[model samples]
Target: MDPEKVFHMTGGVGVTSYARNSSLQKKASDMVRHITTDTIQELFIKTTPKSIGVADLGCSSGPNTLTIIKDIVEAVEGSSHKILHPPPEFRVYLNDLPTNDFNSIFKALPEFYRELRQEKSGGSCIPSIFIGGYAGSFYGRLFPNNCLHFVYSSYSLHWLSRVPPALYDEKGGSINKGHVYISESSPPQVSQAYYKQFQEDFTLFLRSRSEELIVGGRMVLIFLGRRGPDHVDRGNCFFWELLSQSFAELIAKGEVEEEKLDSYDVHFYAPSKNEIEDEVRKEGSFGLDRLEMFQIESNNEDQKDDHAGKIISYGAEVARTVRAIQESMICHHFGEGILDHLFEHYGRLVDEEMGIEKIEPITFVIVLRKL
Candidate 1:
């Protein structure tokens, strides 16, 4: 299946929209803001080009999207002042799949521009900041050669472009049963298929970016990653297991067919640090500067006080986040009717788990410089 056509976060500012349920992502961005700011500042001080090109790939729409742009621009603006150089004109590109909600982002541009003038440019540098949308996969080329000086992506590289073909047998039957992703029940071959796909996709990504970024350009990547070399580490993969248990409950209730569940698989993987380094070493494009593992507070919620409602609200918040992220793919494979039931069950499972022990989601912050 074509990932461009099948994958997208749920759009619009509704109860289930990514725009509304993305606080988890907001927290994630906050966790890595220092790294982002440091990288941008370092790049600006080093290259103060007349027109420095910046691109944010897989930049789904929401306040977080523009907020990141604002932060980067501010970082550059601060650096220019320190170095006593005139502020460089900004040529910013926001990239995502074609089916992403660029319309909402475009409509929100007026306010974004207004704020930029008031806060960033001091009402003078608005025109210097030119923003445009480029819709395509980052697994392929999306910009001109030697054009971009800075590239950033957050919480997106974990998604493979497509399910690995080796996941199926020669007769097109699923090898993984009763689970959407690699789990304890998954065979060792299941993890192998996923690792192979990630290797290919990440190598292609590095090769493509190597041609676009000029020598000494800087890039920051943030995505889900495991702490150890184990492919089936439960520390960061319990949510997926919970999701599979949700489907099992549905099958038990006769709400979903067993055959349908077997055919569906998540096109996502959380690679270990060793695996990521290996792929980058093989690609031979960028130099890895810094790699850090950041863990999110599982109980990051409004009602942190000890109350029954706390767990319920926290579970609901997590379920909402997952629905906003995976709704498109889940609806495509399992139909939209099962979302309410499936997620309700998933939330309960999460609550039970959270009560026992908070399951922190692990993410990696990787800083790269073009060779």
Candidate 2:
């Protein structure tokens, strides 16, 4: 399945929409806001352009959409004011797949613009910030050569261009078998396939950014990653394993076919810090400035209440978050009939198994400067 065509956050303001379930992503974005501000300040200090170009790649439409732009503009204004320099006009690009809900972002623009005006009246030097939506994959070029001063991607870049090519054995049998992602039990070829795909896609990502970013331009990338080079890190692999166990439960009831579960895998992989650094080095376009990993709760806290049971609440939150991002792709692969049943089973598995399963998810925040 084509990820561009099939993959998108569940659209609109429904309960499962990314709009509702993206607090985790917003938190991840918050973790890197300082890096973004510091880098933008450095860029302005070194080479102040009349018009600053900034892009948020994989900017899925939701409450999270346009947030980084607000932060960027605020940072630019604050930096310029501190140095007694006039802030430049801002040209911001919000980019994602063609199938993304750009209209939601466009509809919210008026409020965003009004808020900026209000902030300006509150003593900020408001440069003209013009926002536009660019719909495309970040795996390829999206902006003009040397056009962007700062580029930010949060909670993206882990998605491969496609499912790993080696998912099927030479005999055309599914190699990954019951599991949906790489696990300790997966064959060596499965891990090799995932790593090879990550290497290729990350290299292309850096190369594309290198061509678009001017010399010394900056980027901050934040995404799910492993603590070490191990391909089967529990944090990276076990969440999916839990989901697979859910599928197995459904399979036992004959709610979903075993072959369907066996053959399907999400087109996503979380890399290790070393794996990311290696790809960046091989791409030869950007130099790493900062790389750090930080932990986040597997589920959002707002979903919890004194009334709700802990296990159910945790499972439900995780199910909602996963459903928001992966539902469309899963629907595409397995047909839409099974989504409710699938997530229900998935949630049950989480409630039953998660306490014992050592799943401590950590994310990587990387700041890189163009050569």
Candidate 3:
């Protein structure tokens, strides 16, 4: 699948944008501030230097990116008392896939800069921005070695490009085609191939970032994920599967064609805590400073008396988004007529499944330092 096209459709302006607003950023900022300040103060007895450089890898456009940067500034400021000299200037780099909506990010920057300038103290400080693309992957040689002071990436990097095509080659006779990620019912070999690809991608990421950070520099990653006993099922991105199923149903009903669905695959990985730690260790780059996992409180729960009702309502909304993409061919499949019935079916299924009250838990704020 084309990374640029997928991001434009999903990450450009949709639920992804909503996820990266100022409010979410503020929360992430506070978390990073607390962790970094404590780690720096306790670990490095010496004073910190002025003019710190920070990077937000995979920082898609909007308040979320700015929020993380702001929090880093605050954390540095708050720790000034511990340092003998005045605080340093901040240079922040925002990075993403080439196809990310950089215009939106740029548009939001002036206001973000203004707010920071207004809040500044007497100390001289400069804030700078750099934009670039992480073309192949996030895990290697993106920046000069040992150049950065801090790094953060949120709600991104969980996705990988589609599996290589060779894995799906069919033999002379057997029905075992060399396909990749056909469906949840996809062959175990295909699933394993995708999993191996993610592992390699993540390992490279750790190693690359390890080389980029100064010995004491910090990095944090906050992203959408899941947890379960089984590693294979842990990052259960069922929403995409459901969407695919919906699309298949539409195709069977003559609402769309198989050709349109040809180019896309929902790519995400949800690794267990153990899985993440193991991968990091294997990479041998950074030492894990911290790890924490928590669930974002869903608004549906607070508004409804019946927990089951709330679950159903939330599920229906999720399904609605999926169906909207189908109706509009957002992923380049199906058409508009299927949207109404799509919602109807989704709503019915969710309402019936309310007894399960399923919720997606976001995972892992990992702070790593180059060893």
Candidate 4:
């Protein structure tokens, strides 16, 4: 299946929408706000572009995209006070796949602009900020050359441009059977295929951004990553493993076809810090300003509270979080009928895993400067 066509978060302001389930992402972004604002401030002070062009790739629907823009403008405004140069105007671009729910973000802009206007000074707005949406993939060019000054992406980049070509053999059939991602039982070739895809896609991303960003441009990228070199480590792949285990149980009961299970493969990869560094160096268009990996609890703190009798509810919430992001693709591969049952089994597996040990996902905060 073409992921661009089939892949998108569960849209709209429903119970399963990404906007409701994205607290984890918000927490992760909040943890790095200091780093993000600091980078923007420093870049602004140095380059002093008359109009700062900021692109937030993979910015899904709702007011979150506007929140990013607001923070960036605040950061630049803060730095303008320290220098003699006048504050730069803002050109904010929000981008996501065409299938994403762009309307929600658009509907929320009036409120955002009103809030920005309220922060007025001398009967004028703080900065002349313009917001527009660009719908497409980020693995290729999205803007004109030398137009962007700062770029930011959060919780994206792990998705491949396409499924790894090596996943299929000469006959064009899946090799990693009964599993959607690389698991501990997967052969060495399986890991190699995933890594090869990440290498090519990430290189292409850097090249594309290099052309768009001016010299001395800075970008902040935050995404899921693994702490170790092992592909089977419990960073993010383990969640897929739990789903695979659920599929296996369904296959045994004849509720889902084994062939259908084998036919599906997740178009995602989590690379290590060394692997990321290697690709950045090899790409040679950008220099790493800061590369650090941090961990956050997989489940919410409230979910963890009152855990004595809340295992099932806790697991259900976790399943719902993953469901918000992946239900579209899962429903496309398997029939929609399987979602309730499939996630039920998946939730049980999550509860069991959580009972066994704590699950904290490793995330990478990478700051890159155009050379």
The number of the candidate with the highest lDDT is: 1
lDDT of 4 by residue, 1-371 (tens): 99888888888888678876676688788889999999999999988888989999999875566777889998898898779678888999999999999988888888888887787745854578888999999989999999999999999898888889898889988889889999888888899999999999999999999999999999999999898888887658888899899999888888899989888999999999999999999999999999988887565333442223643356777787788888999888887888888888987888788878766678999999999
Residue pairs of candidate 4 with colliding backbone atoms: none
TM-score of each: 0.95, 0.94, 0.76, 0.94
The lDDT per prediction is 0.88, 0.84, 0.58, 0.87
Which run of 10 residues does model 1 get worst, by summed lDDT? 304-313
In Å, residue 45's CA in model 4 sits off its true spot by 0.4
**Which residue pairs of candidate 1 clash?**
none
lDDT of 3 by residue, 1-371 (tens): 44545443234445323332234334545655666556544433343756566778877555666766676666666667456556666666677766666777777777887787777655546444443334434655678776677777775666664443434456422121321133445666655655677788788887788778777777777765557544333123554454555556666787766655554444556666877888888888788888888654443332322223432355555454344222223534344456666556655554444445554546567888777
lDDT of 1 by residue, 45-158 (tens): 888888889999999988888899888888888888888898888889999999899988898889998887677455445537788999999999999999999999988999
lDDT score at residue 207, model 1, on the 0-100 scale: 95
Q: How accurate is candidate 2 locally (lDDT)?
A: 0.84
Order of quality (lDDT) = 1, 4, 2, 3
lDDT of 3 at 291: 85
Q: Candidate 2: misplaced stretches above 4 Å?
A: 123-125, 298-312
Q: What is the C-alpha RMSD of each candidate to the true structure, in Å?
A: 2.5, 2.5, 5.4, 2.7
Q: Evaluate residue 216 in candidate 4 and report its C-alpha lDDT on the 0 to 100 scale.
A: 96
Q: Alpha-carbon error at 188 in model 2, in Å?
A: 0.4
